[model samples]
Target: MEIFTTVWKDWTMYQKSSLLLMGICIFIILISCIYIITRNRRLIIHAIASILCSAIFTVGTMVILHVVFDERISYIYMLIPLVVFLVDIISLSMNLGYYTSTRNKKSFSPISVKKELLRDSLQLSIFIILLFSAISVFMGGALFTFVIAMGATALLIPWTNYLLLYWIYR
Candidate 1:
């Protein structure tokens, strides 16, 4: 039909990728829910929640900025959710490593891994907020700059958390 053709032609690469990413996120969420139910792993539930929230927020914000405010959304915004998702996967692997490491030790408890992750994530989040604020101030202090800083924060915190955990655990 003519409508299908028009829609197909008008579709941008970003839209295509966004749709794909959303599909992947949905699949992950469903699988994670099943996994949580079967294994009673509450930690994974937190990762699932983070992935869902960050992906939704990133995509929704991009839509609003583009459609409502007529702002030029960058393709880099697409990377945020993907990066967050990847970090979650890596964190899980790292946690598994930590568990094995603790098992081999005489005194270290597995619970310490969760505590360390939570502490590092909180510290990284605080650092990102302060850093973003400082950087945004120097970048002209506009509303748009603030929005950009927030997006960057959403992208940075999980990534930095993963790196810090890797450094400490490895």
Candidate 2:
């Protein structure tokens, strides 16, 4: 633990943030895949949507605050996502237990108006994140690249959500 902590402390701001963000994504994808195993996706899909919102908001705020001020991002940015990842893992485990405990008793309710919006919003955010990630990978996380990626992510989230919501529901 000490060695790992020391190594983490030595990493640059970009490296630390990138590692945390990647961890966030990998955990989210894992949770989503686990969610897919259920016979009904109503709860999981909506849950994914809310999770995505929280993920983007925390990361976006961290990134934007850094970009706008040219300062270091607080660890609060990374910690929130880490906490979410931990929660998701626990939820996934419980979900699996619930699924197996009683085949006749399913907990997920039918999709409602709220669930529909959550699912749609999550889907859109994923698309936007992918588009940005592709661009970032191509450019590489060099100097200024992190800022660009974060800035773009922060700026595009609302636009994407609004556009998708209008296009899909309106």
Looking at model 1, residue 50 earns an lDDT score of 51
Residue 148, model 1, lDDT: 64
Candidate 2, residues 1-170, lDDT tens digits: the string is: 33346557888989979887886777677666766665555445434554576466655655555567554544433454555444434433443454445445554332233244345446555755666566666664342344354534444444443343334334
Against the hidden true structure, what lDDT does model 2 obtain?
0.50
Candidate with the greatest lDDT versus the true structure: 1
Taking all chains together, each candidate's TM-score versus the true structure is: 0.49, 0.36
Tens digits of per-residue lDDT for model 1 on 77-131? 5465655555445545555556555755776653576576666566556665676
Q: Worst 10-residue stretch by lDDT in candidate 1?
A: 37-46
Any runs in candidate 2 off by more than 4 Å, and if so which?
1-32, 60-72, 75-77, 91-96, 106-170
- Give the clash count for model 1: 0
Instruction: Give the worst 10-residue stretch by lDDT in candidate 2.
Output: 108-117
Residue 166 displacement in candidate 2 (angstroms): 21
